[model samples]
Target: MLIRINQDAHPIAPSEITPESLYRGRRNFIRAAGLGAAALAVSPAFAAAKLGAIQKSPLSSTEAPTALKSVISYNNFYEFGTGKEDPARNAGRFKTRPWTVRVDGLCAKPRTFAIDDLLKLAPLEERIYRMRCVEGWSMVIPWNGFPLASLLKQVEPLGSAKFVEFVTAADRATMPGLALPVLDWPYTEGLRIDEAMHPLTILALGLYGEELLAQNGAPLRLVVPWKYGFKGAKSLVSIRLTDKQPATAWNIAAPNEYGFYSNVNPEVDHPRWSQASERRIGEFTKRKTLPFNGYADHVARLYAGMDLRKFY
Candidate 1:
């Protein structure tokens, strides 16, 4: 399942990687600032726990990971709020434990898995992936989880199943933004069955060596490195396999701007903006956006004869 990288082609300088000490220090700083305490007030549900025995995946990108601070602080979790800083600032009291994810529809062994049960489904892997947003921003994230195909296999998708749908949690009490009619409530996303089975698609449980924070889709979330960041649904509540393409939140909200495939294609520009280049969160200058966010070699075949501009 490994996608071999040509080190010479994508050279990662030693200075580029964020120091582990610095990553830990940032979390400590957050705790000292009372954000950690706020989370503890609701319960230890959002408390960060270090994932044990994480296996490093060969499918990982060698690029330096974005700073933990920026990764957590700047996000697009609209359930919490519309502003970039809103999720981090507002999700402190959100509870994530005692969560369950139901996997059903067109499956032989449809079942609901507790958060703890899903964690034990497969050995966790640390995959450093480059995540690109349709808005021309990108980040390298060290995501900890297993390939989503492992979970799908357990449910035993039927022959009739051709797509996978993800439903995200939308607690009105905790997620203030849910009150706003921005898109549909209980955010949903979907992928073609083959895309769901891709090795590059993972069900992320944690990031940066620790369990995810509430703002960053704690408990469980989808991570498709070859696709735009919005394709990665957060705080997942259910995963359904079906024969038809499921309705996705963004595609429903604005079909002209968001496509169902949502692959990172630089050639197909967003209606209001060009997608040829992107600004890395901490970088000064914009870098040329690569096809499939630079994972084209590993995933382009999935689309073979289809026109990307048309499908996109």
Candidate 2:
């Protein structure tokens, strides 16, 4: 089934349908009540199989997408649990509604935007991106959202802004895993000012042509295609622009394992495992990893002259 919203209201469309073995080859996740008014505003089959104004980005991968089940059921959202399947099982009860994101720190205008208001800030686009996890696994996902820079521009960052920090929520009532001291509470991630403002960086609001499921960081999340998957913090509650580099969850927990840059480099091996190759989610055999997760051409210049090994 296809879903759509009114373009005048800024619709978030899905990518073109691929082989059933590729993307959107799973159960429909969005219900009538999930989108509420947005779903009601347009025809039932609005923008069938099209991503509306959200165009297919050139940087997206052409490879077949990982199964939706694998994408949702297997993840590293510690807010739900440490196990791979923990998020899918435990995140169902997590409350994503009534969500808001506070944009503050070194910016000319700092304000809190409710999810609905945020959606109206700019038109949503569909971007298919490759997500490589620090655990050496990977997947290609189609995300629905707008460029994060657009939102940042609205607030107008000051000259002092050098870094962008993303902080997640830690409510035990919604997120049971918060009870555990795993990786510290309120997960955080960061990006350099230039990196954060890059067109490749986006705020993901949905996937597979539907509203995002809680297990997948519903409401709002970050998607930095060139960086490791963990670098994109889920369930984002706040965005802070600061003059100094901000602390990230993994970097704080185990500086030796994860780094501030966390760029996808085959040459830099994880302390416990090799990052030279990774297993595609649905495939058995592993594939050679690429520099900057195969986005080196578009992003390599950003890190030119810097020792990636030392910085990462």
Candidate 3:
């Protein structure tokens, strides 16, 4: 049975969706796991039952929810593997349970919260958000979790804290992708203090009414709807509040290509590709990309007076 939740905040035009990308993206993983199409629709019923139990923020989208299969299989977690399908096949080796997030740096009280404790830190709500990739592809996803601010507030940041750095869990023994010199190991990402505390930014725990898959950044991950997908670091282990603008994995690797802010801007296209348009997963045709991934009215104020093209 399919479950539908009431979302009354974000309005978007009805969009065409397909389960093909989700399935096709993970075809190799499915074949290796001895699973077939039947497994694509699987999600824990308990997770569905837990939905809306927490205080919800009336955040919703009119666009239909992408198929759960596509949402899970079509991923860009380089930790598991670089390919879209790599995580599904190799991420199973990642151990997510007994995870702990170390909150340190310019904070009043440095503390570590276990995965279980972190879930209890705030009310978990389901947010339907539009995710646009830097590669010019996009997907509308329903992410389940609380805002990043919820966790940040618990640790109590000092006044000097300027940037929040997120460090992903990197274990060479389990992560095969680390062998390749893709970006620096133990991927790092950062957000301005205000952006980290933004209402739209969340630390997602699950999606489509189930726990996160290792390939999809199980245990914990950031969700910055207004920025490119890479800005949302996956499988995070450390969240350090600092005074300086922390260098991100992508930005450090390719300063010219990936910027620290990485906000979704059409005017400033990627060096190699056009950012004016994006291909929605499952669709053959491309659609005009929106500034700040269509959250401009709400989030544009965050960058008032500053030049996005320069930071981007």
Best candidate according to lDDT = 1
- Of the two candidates 1 and 2, the one with more favorable lDDT, higher being better, is 1
TM-score between candidate 3 and the true structure: 0.83
Q: Model 1, range 1-312, lDDT digits (tens) per residue?
A: 337799899999989999999999987886776474564546333467788789988898888999999888899999889999999888866788789999999999999999999889999999999999988999999999999999999999999999999999999998889999997988999999999999999999999998888878988999999999999999999999999999999999999999899999999999999999999988888999999999999999999999999889
Q: How are the candidates ranked when ordered by lDDT, highest leading?
A: 1, 3, 2
Scored by TM-score, the top model is: 1
Residue lDDT tens for model 3, 5-57: 55655455456454687768776786554455323323221112233354445
Report model 2's TM-score to 2 decimal places. 0.84
Q: Each candidate: how many clashes?
A: 0, 0, 1
Taking all chains together, the TM-score of candidate 1 against the true structure is 0.87
lDDT of each: 0.91, 0.84, 0.84
Misplaced by over 4 Å in model 3 are 1-56
Which residue pairs clash in candidate 2?
Answer: none
Error (Å) of candidate 1 at residue 132 is: 0.4
